[model samples]
Target: MFRDWFKKDEKNNSRDIPDGLWIKCPQCSQIIYSKDWNENYKVCIKCGYHDQLTAWERIDLLIDYGTFKEIYKNVAPVDILGFTDTKPYTQRLKEAQEATGLKDSILAGQGEVNGIPIYIMVMDFRFIGGSMGSVVGEKVVRVVERAIVDKFPVVSVIASGGARMQEGLFSLYQMAKTSAAIGRLSKAKIPYINILTHPSTAGVLASFGSLGDVIIAEPGALIGFTGPRVIEQTIKQKLPEGFQKSEFLLEHGMIDMVVERKKLKSVLYSILNHLWRKVW
Candidate 1:
């Protein structure tokens, strides 16, 4: 009891100090200072915890300094059946825009990684779970087409909850559109690297998420068509521990490797470097 009292006293006294800042490390559960962590790009020094990054942050971290150029291709919305629930579809679009600060879910552009020019696309989950709708499909197809035309490789970082539910059958067509574009890229022998982020599911998984020439996943990310709970309810059986996790997918031959966040740039650089050595 005396020891517990002393510990509590120490904790209270420590809080009195002003040279303290709190940041959570996802790997080792350490509380660090903001200055220290921001200097280290939010990676935990103790256990290399990779903090969740926004899509824009990922592009910033991946690309060479001052080498990203945005490619804007405005795609009009296709409103079939006048889909609406609870509020008008336009109102939902407005809310999503205000919340995510994005005109759309996917961002595509040209960026240089270590002086090597490449095409890149990333899905912003904050925009309706990064659901692949008509605009997303158009964006992806345009990027892939541009990549093929320019003889550049495409690296797609995806975190999607599958096809957009609001668009119905129109959403499903994107799967075919993207798959066809990827096929064209393959026929041209251009490499496509799919970096699967958290919660990649359903139509997204069925398409480009799994079609990379080299597929990589973050540690412990959940990547599968159906989530564990949904499968459990449908199968009426409990899943084995850690099923459908990145490691499980690696073991099951779905992913090539599980790359840590800090090392992600290095690993991708090596692959692109090796491939470009032969081409450029």
Candidate 2:
């Protein structure tokens, strides 16, 4: 039994270990192999770390038939202040368009999961890290209004850093405006499903990110006003483990549920099924 264990199996340790395809797990900060990360919804194998997902990928997985009617597609931003910072804001917008093949940060549409109709708003983090500006806020309000008019539930997938700084205080106003719109939707008695994705922070969180009837967050997503490091510095103390995380927030009684990416659709379907039973 002891003889075979000590034998040289291969020259594995003789040479340098080559760099494997790596992607940062948004949860654990572990750079893991791309193939494994992708296979596990970008979750880290070592620590069950969940990574951030793009709007396109998220919508494709959550919606049935991959057939959602897009709304508010042409609501482009207007440069009222002639804003510039080495590159013009409009030019930056063009660059983002070319990079993401999306008109703007937000994607609004009507889609169904298992024939249960719902209006969705997915924010693409690729487009300026999904910052919520006036236009993004306006588009979200339009979708909320549409959901109200259609008498359907609203499901918003949020992944944003904060208010769009390029627009200055104008972007900050979206927080209040969007919150008011959600308040109106709430008054309509239509359910709002807020699926908070990774890296959600700042102004967006201050408003609708926490306003869902049943709030759900992807595991390992960062949800907070100020980041952990910033908070630690301000408080002059080291933060606790897993601060601002979905699980941490859940423990502190902030969120309703912490769901994985793969199970999101089924969970949503189940919730909706139970809700719509009394209606129809």
Candidate 3:
């Protein structure tokens, strides 16, 4: 009986040690309590570095509790090109789907932000680097169309390495398709806000990503067509400091505002409320 009691005490003592109690911040390399990091919106308290959020996490952050209703959840990507490199495209798609619990990189839904009804589409970088393929393009166009029909405002959060190269020309075609959809939104005079996150680039940046009525970017986000390394290699010249970053883009008139992660919701709420008097 004493032996059994000692074993039970040992088990209880072992359980007392917390699992994943501390996390290392990628930016500052600061050891922070996991709970504290999460409570601060995943920003490093020491260096103020904002970590990327997954599509669902971002949706929860911006959308009111129990208000987000996802639209076009059934839309899945197609293997039109049957392309393969080191691995089969089908295998890649399946793996990404299972890992992210997402059918594609982009998620479109309607939600209330601070009690204001709005339509939002958010792209996640974890899925194939958040590349926009035919399905992503189609979903974005649909979001704009729904906004037009409902006369509601639209917001698109872009975080992509650009068009999905696996789809070849089919992926390139999405640039034009989404651009045309945004054109319609413009004609309708519906407010379309684009929120550019880390590394918005390539065909996505050239298309609907930049066609926003107001373009806003997160602090330290990279926004440009071609990457700085590629540009430097092609030009055989060194690039300026902080090139294509959100602050640099703001100075160059490429984007409207650069907002910190914590203030994003309030800024968005203010903008949406300003656009629609009934949003309050």
Identify the candidate with maximal TM-score. 3
| True-structure Cα RMSD, model 1 | 4.7
Against the hidden reference, what TM-scores do the models get?
0.85, 0.86, 0.92
In model 2, the Cα lDDT at residue 28 comes to 67
Candidate with the larger lDDT of 2 and 3: 3
Off by over 4 Å in 1: 1-32, 35-51, 76-80
Clashes of each: 0, 0, 0
Query: In model 2, which runs have C-alpha deviations exceeding 4 angstroms?
Result: 1-39, 278-280
Ranking by lDDT: 3, 2, 1
lDDT of 1: 0.84
Task: Report the lDDT tens digits of candidate 3 across residue range 1-280.
Answer: 7687656565556756488999899878999999999988888899977788899988988889999999999999989888899999999999999999999999999999999899999999999999999999899899989999999999999999999999999999999999999999888888889999997998999999999988999888889998999999999999999999999999999999999888888999999989877432
Model 2 — which ten-residue stretch has the worst lDDT? 12-21
* Backbone-clash count (model 3): 0
